[model samples]
Target: MDRTAHGLTSLRNGVKTLPLAPMRDNSEIRTLIDRVLPVVDEWREHLTVSIGRATELTGLKDTQIRYFEELYRQDRDPAASSGVTRSYSLTDLRRLAVFAELLKEGYRPAQAAEIVRSFADAIDYGAAYTVADALRREGDAITDGFLLSRLASQVIFAAQREIGERLPDARIIAMFLVERRIDGVSAEEFVDIARDIATHPQNVLVAVDRAAVIGNESDSSESVWSDDESSIVLFYSRDPWSVPVPDRAQFCYYRPPSTPDATVVFMVESAGYRSIPPELTVKTSARDHLLDWMVRMCLSIFPEFRQATRAHNYRYRSDGYRLAHTRQSLTRLMHRVRDLIFGDDADVSVACLLLPDDLYKPMYLSILAHAGYPEARARQARLMLYGEGEGLSGRAFNAREPFLTLDAEQDLRVFGAQDERCKVALAAPLLSHWDTHPFGVLYLASQRPASPLWSETAFVALVFGNILSELLGRWWLTRLRRKHDNLLHRYVAEYIRWFNGMDMHGPEFNEGLQQIERIWERIAVTSASSGNVRTVVERLSRQYVTLVVLDIDRSRQLHSRGDEPFLLAAQRHVHQAIAQILPDVRGYWFKNDHTLLVLDGYAPEEAIVLIRRIAGRVQMVPVVIEGRTERTTVTISAALKSLSYQELYDLSHHDREVLRSSLMTIIDTIYEQTRGCERTIKVFQHGVWEKV
Candidate 1:
């Protein structure tokens, strides 16, 4: 009876705040009917809800409403209006929203009313035509789209059978005795309780079965029906209830689902007891009321307990489901809010805005595909974000990334965008906290135009869209970092391969260098250009790498920094870090103090990480030195041709630096990258690269 018990004041206030419509004439109705019918026809099946809601919320007067009523009239008795109240369901609210849409679009009350009437007529025709067409094709069998028809029919029949069996018992014995003129007031009251229990007779049967099972039908054995020894004696009796005296002895219960497997007992005595009155009396009636209360308590509390148990199980076995459930819950709440205010016909879409134009092209062309956005459309949207003049079409205006209806009339002016065909749009601002210029934007769009139902669906989607955009941005950031790290690895591997010819401890060094080289090659091939995959590799290699083996004053101390896997991988870090750190040393193009370059061709501006790491480790303070050396590889090639390690090791420290720098330069040179004006660089002294 009270379908709208909550939010009455809020709904009333919202309606009061809305602008009123102007007067309407015949011409306005004709124009609206024509414009609306086409869109409605195009979306006959999917757009039914929008069409219906638009008709309802349009604020038509009684006379205007009568115009529509003539088309779908049913035989009604004059007496039907007596003491009846008209209550609108959610469906009715949707119809009202649709009417509001028509009115808000400049159609006057009368005109909008007439247009809705015509629209309803068209809808009726479309449904009838489709149904007839379908019937004409199929033979004898009907092809209705009701999925659960048979199951529902069977359930209804079974319910009717059970109700049929119980009705006679109540009518003959219970009703006759209670309704008898000689029966006292107490007897009449007992009949009322029986009627309430009979309202849902199946539930009564279940309560009876549960109470009997818990009592074990007079069995006192602790084992009862259980095979396991993990049993405990527990009381399962009717909780307190407002039952009269005669039936007070009929309370019963069994083991509740919330507690562990156990035997039932009396609540007051805390011992095994099942009270079943010998004859139908007032004591039995009172006890039955108490028993029903217990049943209700068990039913209500068991779900919460079961949910908690399942949640605990999911935490250990399926963490993904647990996280997904949280997301879904949030989404569901958003949808409910949307449904309450926006009407059920509203739809949602997303728009993404980006700062600085350069990142757009690469991001749209590359990253959009990964996120399941159409690449061509992404590129077009990218162009819109970068291009000047009234921005992309279908982009939202109020909030940069707010969910908005794309009814075209509402959104076109807001976004300041053009050349896009989206009806609804939502935009997410891709503002980077660290970068002065944002990376780029991620947006979502829907082709379907807005209707009232869109309120709930769009609200859910908006929340989901914002979440998705954040995730995408984070993913992009992580991806960019990984790409840079991988590039650093490539430069290190190449440097190692080049240095292998200079000094070979045994076959192990050769194999290790070969393996490293292969890995670097793969990284180079797989890495994306946006991540600075190539440039990072070359810069670190050039700055930090000098000789294959440095003349260290204290190798023992450096090695004793604990056996953390990260520290142990310093050998590899020494190789990769040099490739990352070198570019910032002003005019230190050819060499630095820790990284020496003799007569060997080294990579340019790379090899910074390794040099910084080893140099930082040795100097323990800043060591500022710059020098250049001749190409070492030219000489090493000749020594390697003769298979002589002694001749290779004879190479100077400057020569090793040149080789390291040259290897680092190889990766950076493959791609040209301009560093951002506000770039931040970090260097780790004790092999930070290895842990990653």
Candidate 2:
């Protein structure tokens, strides 16, 4: 007889003899030992069994056995000879058994393979040490029915039970099948039924009414079964040799009360089983079902559909409904993505959206959500965009790409020095919609160093970053428009107040008002011509302007210091200090060590006095350069220029030429007086000024 046919024949013969044996404990032990010992002996010495024996033992077909062997071979070390004929060891047989069992339980081959691989190492170790030693130690007494069953349970079901324990979904399904077995069926027989279901095609037995069976068989209807109205159809394969089928037909199997629930067991070609329906034939896995549900959920929230709804004017609901729906959909998507990537036990310390300000500094980050941290601690979290060169978020922003560190303490250069909370850190740049350069970063941190979120959350975060960018962009545009409108409104209101303040009924009031209107028109024209509002406004508001020349004393000392970095920093500090004192004053760096300060609404003498006070303050404050404090004073020289509305209005058309000539004369006299003087205070009065 053909080996393949012989293996099938042997399996059939074994099934036939199962019922013929008497129900004595000794007989049961003798029966199991008779079936199992020979197979054990074959693998005991060399730790391997022939493919045919493995096929018969696992109840897997020849092709299925070959496929599993191929998978095992791929997992083996590449150094091993590929030309060697295929063989199965105690380890290989256990994995094969699991793979076959899952297949029989309606899992697709790929799904079964993935699940089996998860526990394959554990199963191999258990088989080698636990089962092999037990078989050798027990010897002939293994035939004692109880001892035989116990050994079988330990060796055969140990890995499966461990797998079930690790995965709650699998445990629930196993418990349902075990608890719902027919009355009088022994635990051993029920286990045999489960094994058989795993090895053969079976009828799917969904409840006729899911509501009626709720909370009875499974915790929830969605757990083990899917339902549709009119009839709760069970999906199954008609041919015993074929793969488990997708949900297509209502297949029912009739069994006596003495038989296990056909809903949970395979339909065997025996006296107790009768198949009733036969159209279901293609295979699907739990993962496939989940993917299908995810697809449906994603499709329901299509952008086109949402856009159409947002554009439509509905009488029943306000426009806010669209925003509410978008938020709801995004929340759902976040939850789903989290669940898929992190599993149930993941702890996400924080999720933040980092944005850049107009200065290109990452000043702060907006917290989206966080877990495993107290509300106070979460609220206290601060992210500095600039000068945070040592952190993962900073690195991501600088690099304009994603960054991940599994063990932040050991792997990261920044953040780890001061922070003990972060174990895993991941950051992905949030790019602008119009450009490839990143405008912000999406940051995530976790206490669990080994969490998969570091690797798995990058792509999803990129997608989310793009979505957030689009949303924030829309909000910013609206805010800018509102600000522009408000600025215009304020300008109009100020103009009206200036017009209304005039005494219209007084003598020459009309002429004065007409002159003011022309001045206003000149101011507007100058503002438009120069593209400077502050310049035009100042010229309109002030009759006189103070020009103060500030010369840093011994500034050449900085060049002699020979430390470029320190010198640059010290210069910046001085400039910043001066600007801080008079924030509204327009100033320019006329030279490396000199600044020209332009002040409106001050006379030359008053400006000179003010400049002296500012100079004293600048000398009093010391600047730190490379850990050393250094003090520097400024020499002050002031000049006053009259810039009345009438004068400005007349000069408006000659704008640059007249203003340049007037400014040059004032600047020249002050520069000449302050040329070689240090700590000098002088005021220009009637073209020539005296030193004070």
Candidate 3:
């Protein structure tokens, strides 16, 4: 169904392109699927078509085709000057089909032939077949026209629903029926003409002249309606299909999604987003072929339309379906990769992704998903397969590249500890554009090492890994967007109600503004344009704080001893240590070297003992740094301060400032004092320091 979505990547966005809006059932209209499919399949076939073949192509006899071709010099077949039994080419066939469509629309042979000649270049064979398909599907319904009331409601509702009335100005709409431009007609006139010409089914397109209305064009090589003569133009066969250069990256043609083979497209120019009574916009239906054509037109010719749809992709639809859609998409790709890499032995092979626990401090990957492994083995692997620098998965993850081992048991990278049945293995790091380095590892192991070519490995590493990362990243972004939206509604909605035409400069109003800003600051994941979450509210109240900061001492020294990964592992080790030492205290990660623990109602004496205990525990953690296991020391800097309402405005920054001035050097000295000279660190009432 050509669900590529003009490259929107529906895989991540989760809006399944709906079925091609079908035409209403019509018994009298002969079915043309067989004929249409053949013409569509041979759309580009350059071979000459015989007079007999041409008759079949257009459902017209030789006499009518000859009369039309001879009468219209513009759509006449190329000059061959062949014998008496004259032949026709594919172009001749398209012209004849178009002419036949026109004739069926109650146009006399002369008028129909004239159109085929005048707009010879404007008509496409794709349009002819599309018109045929529409005719056999819609019957005489379109000729019936729509009531002004229903049409008005559909237009108004769909526009505000899809675009939320964001576009400026009232857009004017026009329709091109065959070669006639039905421009700027009244509501009654529009409906009357629509039904008057509805005798034959036509392939329609809603063309929007973006340049006429839209401002601030985006940086995209999208196709513009070079032939735009109105604000919003509709084209059809019995119709005119706009010329689109599909081979070029920039072109206006948009093929029907229902019939992918129909290359002819009608374009809609979203002319600065106009207004009319509005055109009915229910593009969803088996019988909604006309409105569906409108949708395809805009998406194809206008980048702004595509942008609008992409921007609103998940609002309500994504929140409900994105997770399952993303998971299914990812899983299908994994299974395909497995089949590509393993073939007949795929059932006995294993391919799994290992998402690491933490990026730094303790670097290790766990099996996030797997195939071929029994449930028990998959669980076991999930728990302990890739530990520290233990397996091929770890090797790939740590190296941030692809790793391959022809023999797993004999390879030292496998660590001789797991996946006993696997004889060969391969792993590649999955890279994320959002992250600084690899986000996860794609691991593959087999019961027997099948000889796979380098191309296969490269395919898995490059294509599979990239697609996985894209889907995962998009899914994550969707989730984050949903969270951010919810936060805005929940935290800012109440504050907005107090903002009527109240005093412009009153203290109460200013205070209300401050309160709203503070609420946003505290709750927003994305703040003002910055995407840093400083304080996450676990409990909300006018609670007091005992802010304690812990730092990994001389963290750079670990980098000199081991790779950067080892340095990260060292940080993780320290974080885990601090977490265990003060299990009851809530600590926030503040970079590789520090953890900020905020305690409520803890006395100065309690803060002193807690920091010392954290420092001691962190110093004793056996951190794996640069391939070596060693104990690393940490520096404890602290504060025992209470916050008034105003002080909590920039909570994290305020806490850090207090920690910076808390005499960290003296605190360190006390934690490291010799046995007999041990001293205590304390904060007195009213937030003062005391050394005891």
CA shift at 457, candidate 1, in angstroms?
A: 13
Candidate 3 TM-score, true structure as reference: 0.32
Ranking by TM-score: 3, 2, 1
Q: What TM-score does candidate 2 reach?
A: 0.27
Candidate 2's residue-wise lDDT over 1-692, tens digit each?
Answer: 11231121112213321112112243332323233333333344557777788788788887887666554344544666987656777767767776776666565554455445545554454323347544543442222222222221221122222233333232111111112324455545654554555444322111111222222332231121122111111112222222222222112112212322422222222122333222111122322232233223322322222222221221011101122233345445545555555565444554555444321234554333333345455445555555544367666666667787776767654453235476767777766643344555666666665666745477778788787767645433433433333332323332232333222222222333233344446565666687666776676665555556666666555443221233344444555566767777644444444455666556555676667666766666665443233443333333333344534454434555555455455455555666666777767555566666
Top candidate by lDDT: 3
Q: What TM-score would each prediction reach against the true structure?
A: 0.21, 0.27, 0.32
Rank list by lDDT: 3, 2, 1
Q: What would the per-residue lDDT of candidate 1 be over residues 1-692, giving only the tens digit for each residue? A: 01122211112313432233443454454444433333333232333233234344445554443333332232234665965533333333333434556757765444444345545543233223356544442321112111112211222222222222333221111100011122233534634544443232210111111122233222222121122111111111111122121332222122322332321211111122432221222123222343334434434443222222221211111101111222235345434433443453324332233322233232121122212234455344333433232333223221233344456445544342334445654443444443333343334444445433245545554555456556545544433433333333323333333344233222333343333243344333434333674564554333322222222222223332221222223333332333444333211111110112221222212334333354454333222211111111100000000101222222322344553344444322211111111111222224231111
lDDT of 3: 0.45
TM-score of 1: 0.21
Model 1 misplaced stretches (Cα beyond 4 Å): 1-343, 346-383, 389-469, 493-692
Query: How far off is model 3, as Cα RMSD?
Result: 23.5
Give the clash count for each candidate.
Answer: 103, 6, 24
The best candidate in terms of TM-score: 3
